[model samples]
Target: SQKTNIKALLASDAIGSTVTVRGWVRTKRESKNVAFIALNDGSTIHNLQVVADTAKFDENTLRNVTTGACICAVGLLVESAGSGQRVEIQAESIEIYGVSDPEKYPLQPKEHSLEFLREIAHLRPRTNTFGAILRIRHALAYAIHKYFNDNGFYYLHSPIITGADAEGAGEMFRVTTLDAKNPPLDETGSVDFKQDFFGRKTNLTVSGQLQGELGAMALSKVYTFGPTFRAENSNTARHLAEFWMIEPEVAFNDLDDNMELAEDFLKYLINYALTHCADDLAFLDARFRKEEDKKKKEERAELGLLDRLNFVVANPFERLTYTEAVEILIKSKPAQKKQFQYEVNWGTDLQSEHERYLVEKHFKKPVILTNYPTHIKAFYMKQNEDGKTVRAMDVLFPGIGEIIGGSQREENYEKLMARVKEVGIHEEEIWWYLETRKYGTAPHAGFGLGFERLVLFVTGMGNIRDVIPFPRTPQNADF
Candidate 1:
């Protein structure tokens, strides 16, 4: 008989039917007459209990079926006598594919810390915590594609390596084929990129929005979901050297339309998690509460994980302009009491603390702040009539300050070029982007949702690294 996954077997009603199951051993307990083997195949959080009669199997084989060992069991599925699970397997024969020495297996049966698991990322998936997280991550990715496809958006494949700095941050991982020791150099003593593989300087792309906009211009609606890199040296829990970004560009969308799209898109994802990933969400919610309990009384979340997710989906995000948000923050208790580490100032970028104050303390829900200062925003954002602010928007979540950042793109060629010059970005570097405005520009808007950040919020994982499989941080890139 073909092998049945633990997830299917757990939900199955085929009592008394013989089934073959293959998975890594989670745990094994022995009595004089019988032994119980807990097995998991990464299909679900729950493990299948395989009841084995010690008299029927070889003693050596049974001894080898320790934790982390891979085994195949031929058994009869029956209603479990245990309380936690519905069904279990009565093993007739056991075949060991691989044996893990009990003395050497690092993952002994116990609650392991998230930091310790990060060190052994290769085996962390076998754990319930990571298994649930990865499953939800897959579900969210599926929902993202499904939602976009259902809403008439084409998935665009943007290049990973590019020459232009889309965000104008100038922090990029340079891609080159030249010898690092001593290579081509110009008379100016600068390492000449003209002789490089691409014949010009290039780096790993920071965002696909610039290329995504090109697709949107033609396709009317397009989104790019791919890996992006940043060369920032910051080693904070929130920042990653490499991460995934979901950027959607829509033609003829203004700031309000952009805000609406962002709000609806976020709610859809959170709702999908609540509906399709209930088991995983329940597990994570318990984990989230434990973490919450560790915090100081004042710092604990007002709503639990599920409550927070439901609140976002059921309520409309409070919308305000950047100027208005600054005013609120200025008069707020945190700012007045000098609690905020960064001072709240007009015409300046809002830090994560300020954003959290607005979303968590003031609004008590998701908030969308719009019309940010032009100098503080990207050059692509549409310039407003006030001349001080651009048609930019950022969606702030309860725990995560800014989950999504987007704006109505600047459609006027002259204005865009002026901003480009003002920002000191060479016209030749983004000549193609500028040409789009000159020829057939329409009011288009888009936003980037950090894929890991979304997963962190959904999984209620504290560190951004915990959500991603193999995180690339400042000095670490282990498997």
Candidate 2:
């Protein structure tokens, strides 16, 4: 008996061998002759089937084990008799490690709604989808560190409680101690933030790019991979109130350099995910995808398990300037008159829908959309020579829009301040930021990649909430 991955056991080499494994019973079926229990131990996405005869194992013991009960078993591994599965365990010994109370247990082997699953967040990890997601998340995280470390980039930890809102989207989750009903006020009658939790108007960081830029200035290359909070109330599948972002900032880099770095970085991530999270990827491919998608995946698997990601990582992303992108849109979909919904004349922020159309339809590959209007982009984006567009780029991929948004920072102190003023952002609170531009801020560039969004693209999960372990939404914190 040896410890082995369930997927490896089923698909690879463990036939006609005895193995001892511990796992939670997903569900069990009992009969007079034998009983079948589908088990998963977090080793892989696929469950290890355990078939035991009623004569050898106590019927009462098997009957008492609930859907989510933890169990340890020693058994002979044998090939499946029918077309059900590849491998199963023939039990020689059975031990009920922890019995689950049936009435209180949330998982019941039924297809539960995602909302329902969110409510049982504590136990949802036991399911196949979540199990695969966590594994992929772990592998991707490891790959990120490996990618940065191998490339001579310093790994910098940005503070969670920060004085800056980097996105400037005004989505900062506030951190305060003043009572909402009756709070202490300053002489000016404003709520006194001095007595707050951080002793100032502190908030959870919306993005780590700004602090990461500091490290980039010093170290030349640095990345901050950590949790970022957004107080945005959007409840779409793509948006999350709390999630992780990997912000890699580079010094003396322009928008082109930034796009190249982003492309390489994304490919590096996809490659790492493919090699390391094979089991998880396989699990997700089989279980979560729709019937047609699963069949498509099966056919794709015949080509390769990582074919889609391989195409992305190996292929050169098609580059399109914002103007070219707009032209392409105009020529391609002139019939749709709702371009009015975009609400911008020639230069403006490209909405998510526009980004999707460009990547999913026109490019049919990852697209690096660059040279956006300076008015819509962040203030830090380096002003292009045209005196209008900024050297900014948003990497959009098929099925996912704006996977990474970045730009070459505005190095000139005066112009930086002017843009800051133009944005109506309070310059007083962010003096340290201006100082960077003043004293030795080497033309820096960086991008913010939503880690969950990348997971969605890589795993083909379609929803950001499904990839994160515990999705925190405005009205949801069920478990």
lDDT over C-alpha atoms for residue 185 of model 2: 91
Off by over 4 Å in 1: 334-336
Model 2, stretches more than 4 Å misplaced?
Answer: 1-18, 77-87, 101-105, 286-307, 336-344
Candidate 1: residue 314 Cα off by (Å): 0.3
Q: Residue by residue across 1-479, what tens digits does model 1's lDDT show?
A: 64779999999989989999999999999999999999999999999999999999988989999999999999999998888999999999999999999899989899999899999999898999999999999999999999999999999999999999999998899999999999899999999999999999999999999999999999999999999999999887678999999999999998888988998999999999999999999999999999999999989999899988998899999999999999998888743438688877898799888898888888898899999999988889899999899999998988888899999999999999889999999888889999999888899999999998899899888899889999999889888
- Candidate 2: give the clashing pairs: none
TM-score of 1: 0.99
Candidate 1 CA-lDDT value: 0.92
Top candidate (TM-score): 1
Model 2 earns a TM-score of 0.90
lDDT of 2 by residue, 55-156 (tens): 987766887667999988889998888466888899988899999988888887887877678777888899887888888988888998998899989989
| Number of clashes recorded per candidate | 0, 0
